[model samples]
Target: MTLYPRPDVALICGVDEVGRGPLIGAVVTAAVILDPTQPIAGLTDSKKLSEKRRVELAEQIKQQALCWALGRAEPHEIDQLNILHATMLAMRRAVAALRIRPEWVLVDGNRTTDFGIPASAVVKGDLLVPEISAASILAKVARDSEMQALHLAHPQFGFDSHKGYPTAAHLAAIAEHGVLVQHRRSFKPVRQVLEQGGL
Candidate 1:
């Protein structure tokens, strides 16, 4: 695919998110404004990068980019606002937190936030845009780190292994240990499990 370059270079920001489908923990979003002249090599979608590579690239993106910021929507907030809305909220927060006000916003997915700036929503944008890819890496790494910390407190759930996503192992652990505060009760899988013998 021929990825489109930013139409305008002045303060162009790219946005992407992580952990939206997780059954536990907060959803994270990142917005990054890159230096059009100095591009970071090996920047790509977070899903395409290894954990080690993602860590390395995130550091590089942070140090090399003009500015970047991460935002999160907690489990309670996700439950209250729903995933789609919460994801947009996180995206908006990320963009707002950036040190520079962006002229154009390129988002990783179809949803556009109310940033009051001109924005474009590109499907699978993280794969196509360098700045979006950088944002994706940052958000993924940050959320993974947070989940690792959660694993220490809730060892029974094995949050580190599944990263709060709804996998068979994570579901089984939830079934055995019962719902913790981190579990999103609003999620159908969690709600179903809770109804089944109070697991």
Candidate 2:
């Protein structure tokens, strides 16, 4: 892990969210506090890594991080609160779930919610901060696993392949198979389909 300069802070937490754009499932967030002594190599943005690498790194992170927690806002919550607010809610929950309170928090985005701690939003932080990258990988792997499970239950929707994103295939599947309970009714494509009585 790349050591960041934090003058008196011993516990620094990194935060990130995944699945915000997906039409189904929850918006997942993760908080990670890395152990300075347990450095994890090859940490970077989850999107920059292959699926195999991400899965491998995710395991390492779970085993090695000082403390880590995941939080999520379900599809119903996403529809009620909107993606932005729901994402913030998830982030807050992630930090709250952490066993160790961090002296400082860094979020991987341009905006951060009130974490009730010293927190800053770093644009593309997952690329620059190892802790944020670790959170990103964990959130992604968790969400993708949810999608894979959803696929097994409803393979017609292709959740495993597209991860519930609003891809053409996913849209077509919704049109043909109707909306699943897992789909977010607030999303444009899903809303359109529902309005057209496609569900």
Candidate 3:
């Protein structure tokens, strides 16, 4: 068996996910490899940046990164596999979708996914690693856009405002309007509502 070499040159990719806490929609992940020659400034955790800055940085990352890809696991999948496993699945998919194979992946958070490619998990890596920050921005922008689109389909949930998070507004909406097909039934809040026979 030919063993993969340790990450060097263009072989290391950064990975991150967004929408893990949302009660609806998919857990979206991104994998990005930045070109050493073209460095992006102001890279940081996606949550720290304003929506405007994240959008701008996301576009810049997409245009300048050596290669990047996104992956996601739908609510049904999250319910079936659990959030942690579904997140791993999405991360693996993102890595696999890369046009060029990476020797290793650096992922944000404390647990690493079994993506075939070797991976190391770093706490707060999204803030410290430029590539990971880029990935975070990409994932956040993609998932936020998805939430906006979802709002168009089901305005009752206020997806565009809360992004399906278990905010008071969303909970109240669910209590008033009942659950949607996109809601994660496995989540405690949604499960409680379902057990109570819905709205």
Please rank every candidate by lDDT, starting with the best.
2, 3, 1
Error of 1 at 38 (Å): 2.0
Query: In model 2, where is the ten-residue run with the lowest total lDDT?
Result: 1-10
lDDT of 2: 0.92
Structure candidate 1, residue pairs in collision: none
TM-score of each: 0.95, 0.96, 0.94
lDDT of 1 by residue, 71-123 (tens): 98988999999999999999999999999999999999876878999999988
List candidate 2 segments past 4 Å from native.
1-8
Q: Which stretches of candidate 1 lie over 4 Å from their true place?
A: 196-199
Global lDDT of each candidate: 0.89, 0.92, 0.90
RMSD of each: 1.5, 1.5, 4.5
- Model 2 residue pairs with clashes: none
